[model samples]
Target: MSEVPGPSKRFSTDNSSFSGAKKPRKTVLDSCTSDENDCSSEEAVYSQCNDGRMDGPFGEIPDHLLINTIETPSVSLLRSSAITPTVSEQSFILPSHIGVAGYSSISALPSFDDNNRQVAQNIDDQPSHEGATATWASTGSMKTLDFTKAQELLVPVPSDPLEAFLLFLNNDILDLIVRETNLNAERVLQQPGVTDKYRITNWKELTREECMTFLGLLLHTGTIRLNRLNDYWKTHWLFNIPSFRQYMSRNRFMLILRCLHFSSDPRDEDRLTEIRPIVDNFNTVMNNIYSPGKQLTLDESMVLWRGRLLFRQYIKNKRHKYGVKFYVLAEPEGIVLKFQIYGGAHEETSGQGHTQKIVLKLLEDNLDSGHSVYMDNFYNSYDLAVKLLDRQTYCTGTLRKNREGNPVDLSTVTLKKGEYKSVFLNNVHIGKWRDKRYVLYISTEHDNEMMEVTNKRGQVLLKPSAIVHYDNFMSGVDLQDQMLSYYPCERKTMRWYKKLFIHVLQMSVANAYYLYNKFSTKQRLNLYDFRLSILEKLLPKKTDQLKVLKVEHKLTKIENVKLREKKERRGIRTIKEIVRKECKGCKQIKKRVATLYECKGCDGSPGFCTQCFCNFHS
Candidate 1:
């Protein structure tokens, strides 16, 4: 400079605005301003501007021109035209300057008006960056979220008491009971005397209401119909459900029918015809109501009924007077399966004959045959046993003392009463009437083989061919022991009552078997104990009177009894005819007229009095 400046400050006539700048200008020699270098500088500035890199001190150009340059020119051109902007340079540029600079004579920047708003609307219509990124991330990710765990967190936990109660019920137990009972929701809902208090609308919640409903259904299906459920409830050691009391009120007839049916004969056509449809319907209903895979035992029972009804003309076998018979086929667990009423003439047939007919009919009908038929000595006949064998059924019962032939000798044998021994027979005839011929056979061997057989009246009969044992006479200290077990007792007191007692005792044995199977355990029970247990629970308290009222009304009209008179013949009288007199009129020939005149119109008397007709008309 003319007045030499310090080294840090420099100026030139063309660069006077560069005074006080941080950098000092060089002399002509030091600057070395060649044409090639000048060309290079111009090219750098043009490239930078065209590349849209103008910023900070170099970014003073108007926004319109700047925008136009950016729109039209390539980034390389901008970078080559001028120096590339640094981070600091780019940061300082005003947003307004983005399109105003006319470096490329660019169009004006968009204003915040309708056209710009529409453009913005178009931009808004495009998919968002965040949304696109999310979609990409979801598709590209390797690990996935576990939904079950998530659902557990999202769903609300049950807070209601009823809902909590239901969670406690064992699903398996419920399913088991439902399948066994075979009950439908509607049937359960409509059970007699089922109060709304115990009605369950929601099964998921095991509330008191649900318990009541379950109990109601159970009672409806089980012994409730048989009149034994009350006994079971009262006697069973476990649960004491009070709700069953309400069911007893309306189902007495049904209960009675169940009991009668259970203990009656299955072969009596009259009873079978009357109840078959009902039993079939019950089975169908039970199937529909219950789940499959539940099983029940099939067994037989018998009851005896005798009265005026047995002698009615409409009743079959009305001719008989002494004995009445009822046949009952039941489930192994004592559920009634079928029943028949037999009396009068049918009783005259051998008990074996009756039993065989019934069993055969049931087999032919495909009713049920899962268990051995149990019977007393009367039903145990060789012919019947053979028939059962033919039908593929087992028979477990006592044998009649007087069978059909000469008894086997067992004098030296010390076998127990009701115990078996083998004996060979060369000629053993079988079957009813004369249909059977001689056959070889092996029969039971017992000490009473040659003893005289008798009926209840003690009438001795011809010795039977086989010496079969009566189950009643078998002795045991533990009466509940198995039938085959050894025991000791005097056989002298064999009577009908003893036999009957034996039958009752067998019921206890059967029940014990049932209980053992049911609970998968070994526990014995006797009839007396069983009956006592049942009575204790079943007997109503003195204070609890039966709700039904009994009324007896007599007919108002009195009827006279009429008796028929017997006809009698009198001996002829010959002496009374000696006093006959004759009457003559107008000298006509006349015969003597008797004091009595007989009229032709009437059988033996005249219309007038006998004296007047005889004396005046004659």
Candidate 2:
């Protein structure tokens, strides 16, 4: 193999001009002075052999290419490889390894043919390649830099509403629901019903589609009051035109009654364990279905349930004084991006305080730069603000007066009604104002400024931008709650977990409606109309109406006798038997007809002479 040159050889700058007549000289070489291992590499050295040939790892370097340099040999060799042919007149080889600045690879160099000498001369006249090697020499440290770390952040949006909606209610969840329903149905049928006539029997297992349609009907039906599913199934009243059985049979509906969770072990401590997969699976789907916008809000939403449960909560101020509480993060359009069920103190997260921890957990996947979050006083704190700010996120919310790290000046400052003041400190802005009451707000995004606002009476007033934006944006979760409550599928259930399942089901439907409006090609539909459409699709095909009977032709002799027998069983006399048909004869008056019955055979008819019948009988 040909040997590469060592470091001692040097090319003199005095002979700057290249001449074909002069024998090609050895490349310049400098000994490795530093202890760094970079200098010991093959490309680092150029030396002369006994035959006067320059050799190192690089066998034969041309003399015209050698530039006299007193600097490090290794860096110069790498920088030399980055040079490109100026005019593209001919082709030359460049090392596959080294890069040009941050560009991936070097372009092809010009070949040294007589036909390309003019092209090379023209290229040398141009200034584009000036100090190209020097630039690369200065950037030696950047060769190992990872370009992938600078990737742009991307958020996903769903193109199809139906597809996105069905993701949360996947086959796995439906299968589990079916299995649990069967288990409960078996248990229910084994026990007697409220009445002997109403005892359940031969309950069949529900198919996945049937169960889904049943849910759709429940959502579409609004509210109903009936003694049993059989009543809804069989009732033929005008008001119940499309009977509940049109969507799902009574037996199938009864199989899943009050049974969302199933456990093989009857004595399992956590009855909710069986249905926990649903919660996890649904949350995952919803999280990945659509990415939230830059603005988000965090607050608590209640799933109404007045039941005896270990995690059941009661908030006096809420419309529902008793229910399960869920901490939710939502977009301004009332879409729930993420949520966590509060299972008492045991549900505590690993972080600061409960409220701050909940806020952090809700905003975990949404901590991108410039993303703004709004919340109530329960979650706003200085520590949370700082932490979010560090992650390049901005947070704004109402702040409690007693919170730690609040500005002392904010607390001491007193203002009259309709007056406000604000202070900026450490990227956090604190605003204080008094209207009917004192309001304090903390934010990282807003400045201490007020904007003119027109009230309902058309009176103009000045409101702080922070307060205005907070009011407008902080209601995301509240808006979601309101939307959910409008066509709510919540039913009174003693089983807390079942109520939760129902709550999530309603949420999924509402979300689907929202997404449909967002992406649908047809006219947008409201929540009620959307649910009705889904119900229509899910319901069984309508059959032809049965023929009706006329009143006069409906009752024949046999039918009349049957009606009489039915009525007589309760001690009621029939009209046909009550009318007197014959009369018995009186004394002197000629042929007097008795108004009462004289004989059994003659009195059976409606018209008969009592005197004639009595005389004839005698």
Candidate 3:
């Protein structure tokens, strides 16, 4: 048995490059010191080894290629064998791996020859099953799918990010929120054994404008992170955001956050009942506003939530491995086209495989338009490619070679780096290429051709066109996930649906920004600046010192003694300005009641509601 020299042994600049004995663990390519080489023999070795490789992707073939290839779909699939190495192959071994540096090993070539032979014949002769089976053609042209759908914006795209965002969160949605919020507050106050802070007199009905301001504060807090919500309204100038103190009182903000309800229905049977309003409304407006372009991508994304959830998923590869999972379909550049929540196994699929159902459902409206979808191996299959073609959609992605309907001999034919094997029948093309490792792909579009691409190091390289196109279009969901992750509005909460609701709001913000860029002709704004613009627009009419926190106003012993002696001159009076605050009188007895009037001749200008004031002053 001949030894296969590891990577380092085959490319050593030192001519006595037979250092295989010295470096026991290193590969043939590792021993080479330089990133480049002028080795002529190595070039000949690559050319000789990579002969008759497939050109692009799926190509022309007869209909019989995909027949069960066996008796049952559930039957044990064939495992392609290690191609018996030829005499010349055994002799001409270069352990060094090819990289983007343009085949740098400068070494003498060992003698070998299989130039006149066809690898397709070898692939065909090797039987994967007992019966005669299909095999790769080794050489063929591909038919890459062109993205033909140029979408028109369904509505006039707004130039302002805030207006674009408002298209989804319009007056109707805001009004519903206001009504429910107010109703829920009243209901909470009426509950048995309710605390004094939540009493009917202490609760003020929330207005639509106030709701917008509340959301603005939430969005702003997402960007300027702090340890606690109270920190934003702190009295100290060093840490306080004056706008927070002036626009909304701290207790009021907490009140809104606590009682922020989307639906009035108190049913626990439907887990999604609480947040269904926002999710349903946002999903509708998202697709109605803008149409996506030719290329699309489908994948799952996770929202970072480690708390208790009925349907939370743990995906080891995801950035937020433990969270609620969402199946997302989006354009290649990060615009969310459609999304569905994974509510559990019951809601996962209708009647098909999980992959097929998700892809079909997400593309339900976008299909039959000649658009191409790029996916990873998890969702790629020969069955899926064929199913998509039936709907006039082209599917391109890496496939699991062992998946049912794959060619019998593909595994049998081993490929070195830069080499590929492919067989086609009609529109479906299945192929495996060797790069850093083995890669299997199935595609309905994309012809067999090499594409010139540049690496980050600015080096030019040639890759299969299918591989290049897949790399270009497959990160849509990931990109959307990345943008949403930038300024997440979600916070710690006991309700999983609330966190989910906040996450959907964050998605709307992202979609709004994408729309702003897509339509507005003027100076484009980044996400942070765009969100800032929206926040400013959504802020309620400002007031002069609504809830000023006087942290240093703690009384000394003398002041504390005087605080008990309320003079007759101090009186309950209505101030010209209408502001909501915790009543000073209510606070005296450890209660929290909102007041609309202020007390005259008071040291701190504390507020007092009608009933609470007369009770305190009397």
Candidate 4:
């Protein structure tokens, strides 16, 4: 797998704005003793207040929700006081409505103390809410996790890295880019102030080969970087990529980059119309190249573009906080299977929330194929997980403790650093384990069991089976982002669409590298080597020199033909069978030659062999 940042240091969940100052996450959370207030209806060690009152320890509750379920002791009560609570900006509201068969009014509720277990979250994470417990009502029956579909590569991958890369950005896409680039040039020339012919005279229509070479040069800059763009073509020994000049001149490269276009007839009202071709083509090839394995991850990738435009987002949880947000469905090992560009607030449809709609939309093709998806709190919900389960898909992810549809025992309960609470309902196993902080996990794939995971410091930590699986598969997109950062192809551009194209180009190259490593039986090259090889193929030095030599030879032959023709027009030159001197070129090698042609325009008009006749001409 590609290198990615450890979860311990990653940014927060995808979306959250701090209402107050953000505090540093503690490396080692303060440990706590076992809870003394351990009695609950579900029989876990959930802590209570200093006084005796049945209350929700994890989140705020509404009186109506509590008053309706007065007879239910486990309605919103903590299952254990020893379980640390998950920090959440969202407040958990108890769901309303329950049968009041045992009792009627709120006065019959049990009394508790004021001594409450330490809420693992700061007040900033979870807003304060207090009331009675709500009933842990059932939602639906748990269906069996029965998935038996097999995924195979529809097309064969070639051994060549360039070929593999082309699988994603094939010739059709390149041709499209070429056509649009030329179209863009025509469109620009048709505009005012273009007849000056300063940059226009040098502008020629783009070609597929040159277009790919432009991408190659873009990738090359990442490898041999300089402080400035013009440095690559400098004549000085200190700042010259000599081979770069062999493929394209600096002026030509910049001109192509300026005129680069992706689509025709773009719609201004449509946010993605300008770059729709690239996005659509890349997605199609991504799906056609290889079908993903059983385990997939759903997440967001932030392409850094701090420009002014609509739908530009600030995800505090992402390292690149301000940029275009992409909802990506990728494999566990950093293969982007599908992606959706966030257009604006309207990207999220009405009825369903933004997170649910995006997740479902990105996973449309892979749904019900027995793929197990892992996600963070940004997308994972009890309702979504149950919904995926109903579709024969499995999902496991860390949830906000207060997310709606959470089991009351798992959602409202507070536990110490080592305790946990788990309940299975509708095949969705919602488990809250206290390990430094509350880890609320909702899963349709894993059971309510424990698993061991090694931490960054090589220490063993016991986590739920779902949490372990989440840790294992949750970083597919992050892996892609991290690998991309090492040698990025992005440069500062005024056009936001240009930035998007460069970002997608980088993703395609990364995808190509993954396929190369996956299929090549030879000793696999690292990303740098793989990228360098692709660069060499796209802009080769060997053929450039040969082309130079061939052009020189052809130019000389044509120049002589023109000179001979000019002399004939003047009637100043004539070919005669004279006592021919041996050819100068052949005589040098001591080979005798009797030429039928004589040199022209020289004072002597010296007799020479056919090959040496042009050498003696004035």
Candidate 5:
């Protein structure tokens, strides 16, 4: 068996180059300094024996020449083996003892031909250790290798830093600048000095108060420019600029207008105050606009006002002492068709009558035909109703009771109440004290209209069997309750005045809420809830002073710091104690001691001197 050269016996570069022709010289002796190991020398001698043989005379050469020539072929074999797969020749046989050893057996194991051949062919295929060994054993001479453990080292490709920085600037810096500047332009146009023509320019141009006022108006009008506001904030330079905080103030006049247009409740005081002056001016406006062929409901609203002298002098009726009354005429929807405010001293009878006459005269002078008038029973007398009828306008109201001196038709009286039964008269006279004959008509036929009128004792008095009858039109308690509930007031004393006011204010609030609901398309909120929500958002705080705080450094130095300190020190106190002796001159009074001073005896005589008193007295 031939021995293979170990790693220690490897040739050096300088010696291998100097070896002669025909056969290479062994350079191992020069490559390694001799160590005190016999196994290494033995191994080298064995390696020299297996080195390639030369033919004839060359083969018979001296040991030194043989060694040199033999080393070349062995080195060449090892070099080729490292780069490519090893091939075994028949002469290179393994020794029996060495082949039996565990180390030799492992080295002699079957090489991986199938699995590792695929791995070697494809650069991406990674082979396992067992696979590589099996592959080598199967293909050629067995050689132990761990190609699976090998790692492919990589080098990162370089990038241009300047180009990367420019990209970042384009996306993060330049783009941001463009957005901010555009918003700033918008803000500038909102400024006070900016013309309405240029109002779209920029956000920074507007003052904070101006911006907020515009926002408030838009909100009140239910015109939210959400997208526009967002765009301005995104781009405007002064988007986050601070300003002095102020509480939002409500426009009372606008609120009043809202009420007048929408509220069904007539008793809101605030709405009443707003409507009062407008009511006084109503008649004047109507006179200007009157060409009336239009239908109008003429009615009066009682208003309450406070004044000491007026109340005392004009309130001969005890009820009038608290408040004055006003008359208002309007459409059925309470539009203030016309109105008048009478003085407190005005009489309900003559004063109201005179006012009606004046109103009628004004209508006659300015208005054309086809107009109809509506009034309550109080305004409906035989004389006035007939007079209005003569003016080519129809009048409708309850008639006064005790309408007498008219001839009766017994047969027609049998007809049921609320049942239409009309009679045409050849000549009808509506005299001041006499009943007039006319056609009677009823609109609804309900059974309740046929009820008997009776006294509290269950005795039937007058059964309502006639189609037309004269009876007192009692003011309905249910109507009063409906009126009061709809137009809530503090008390019945202010019922009329309060109802009028409340109706107006509620109308306005309702209108505003309606507008908001219409725009929002949100069904969750009702009119009342919507108004409250808006009120909360708009008027977050009640007072400006309460909301103000000294947050700025300069402002803190001037005001808040000292005030805070003083408030902290107000409750502390200090005390001091002094030691003193008790007086000895005052006490030594005996038992009862009834006559200690004797002032009574001393009062009558100058001789009984009172100059000295007991110590007890002192």
Candidate 6:
């Protein structure tokens, strides 16, 4: 019910290549149609030449009938005529098969007259051992269509989804989090049992590379139980990486993770709202990159989340029935173009209904004349179809008979199996077909025509073209859901925002990888290979020197509080307990520096040389 906007300027077509070619002038074509020997004229129309016998018009035995309407400069006379015959004596004959039953074969069809015989030679010259075929036989090799050029002209190449993903988490966001966390450093360090000086307050702004490494670790390392952090630190290869340890510590990671701020204030309602920035940043990047084709599908998907939430949905049929609901618009290839997070009871709707509004919003920026949108019965209605038609967009969707504004006569029609009826009301084509169950469909594009479809059992059934196209294209969002589930990135999270974040991240990765395959000039990487590439980029292999270290040495160092304090730096006149306990400094000769100091200000006053203590403390 919203005012539909014009087609997106970002998705505007580049028709310069097509429009640049001037329309073929009629005069040029008229020049070729002369009256000499009609067979000698370029525009001579003829029927089948029966084994080199002229049966059709003008008594001219010219070659093939099919003509190249475009691209070819000259009209090709399939076969040349030795002599011109009178118009009254001319007769036309349809091509006939000599041997085969139902099949048409052009093989061994005779060539044209002597002057231009080779021009009309059949595509396949080998004699058919079966029935002699005709009518639909290939005349000659048709010029191949170059699909690469066509695709380039028609479809805009999608931007890398990975780049978009990283763009959303750019350096500005990292610096913002660091700046905010540093403001609350005192409170973080004052927490109970906070003994490590290098813990919470040592926050630093993360580089893009470091942030990438952090996300890589989060994605690569399955999940760690918070209670068993030390266990993972000791055994997990990812946690033991020297570079990772040097850049961040476990406690620091958690502290900063919790302290991340997208806005200036946590208590400000507008500032702390979590989903806003994420959704905006993601949608901005997604919309600017890929443009949807004329055919689009609208459907619902679930981001599986079992945690407590007000907007979580539980559909009886969905695989993950209980999760965050998303209304998605996608192309036939399952590339997501736009999406809306369902707010459940809080959603605003117009008189057209929630489903209708969802569709309109998804297509608000894509209301071009040639665009066709397909949906299931849930979002289909006579009024909705008319609305889309008014915007110069086409709509095709299955309908419910009992829905408001449906044609009463079509819905009431009694038809046996494999039967269908179609009727038009105000430019809306309504069709009712009986398959396993009777189905009603409304379309602005298709007529009531039926097409023969062969099932797996080889049974031919007539189905409406509307139904066939709906079945083919109405699964875009569902296909996207399936692809995302194949290598699911969802993990257990207590925060609903975190659950949503990970879901969006997974979507971004899948979309990026899908587009990469579609547009890449090099050998395309499959989903598995694409993911592997991301893993390698995020967490590169360790250096050989680090790889050779003992597992125990690689693990997080256990802090000996007593020995640590003993090595504390002394003031100018500070007193020290010079302990002879293994010298604590030298192994070769028991050389103990008198500079070992103990201070009451620190816990567990263990002795330490001034130099060792200074290096250890800070």
Cα TM-score per model: 0.24, 0.60, 0.66, 0.67, 0.29, 0.58
Q: Which stretches of candidate 3 lie over 4 Å from their true place?
A: 1-148, 197-201, 264-270, 348-352, 540-618
Candidate 5: worst-modelled 10 consecutive residues by lDDT: 553-562
Candidate 1 overall lDDT versus native:
0.31
How many Å off is the CA of 225 in candidate 5?
31
Pick the winner on lDDT between candidates 1 and 3: 3
lDDT of 5 by residue, 1-618 (tens): 334555555444466545454443332222222333222442353243333432221123332323233233332221111111233322234444532122211211122243332111221121211212221210121112121211111212113222211221223323333343345454444567856554243123323333334333333333222333222223123442112123322332222222222122345333343235434333443343323334455544433345332322233433334454444454342334344444343333234347456457434532334344555544543334335444545444443332211112211254343232322111112211112343332111111134456667988653332222232222221122233233232223233433344433333333233323333334546433554464444445546454333322110111111112122366744443222212222222222222212222221211111222332223
lDDT of 3 by residue, 59-128 (tens): 2212232111122221122322222112332222433462212222111111122552212212222333
Candidates arranged by lDDT, highest first? 3, 4, 2, 6, 5, 1
Of the two candidates 3 and 5, the one with more favorable lDDT, higher being better, is 3
Instruction: Evaluate all candidate structures by whole-model CA lDDT and list the values in order.
Output: 0.31, 0.59, 0.67, 0.66, 0.32, 0.56
Q: What is the alpha-carbon lDDT of model 6 when measured against the actual structure?
A: 0.56
Error of 6 at 145 (Å): 24
Off by over 4 Å in 5: 1-278, 283-294, 303-324, 344-366, 403-618
C-alpha lDDT of candidate 2 relative to the true structure: 0.59
Per residue, candidate 2 scores C-alpha lDDT tens digits across 264-309 of 4453444356456666776787666665567778888888776577
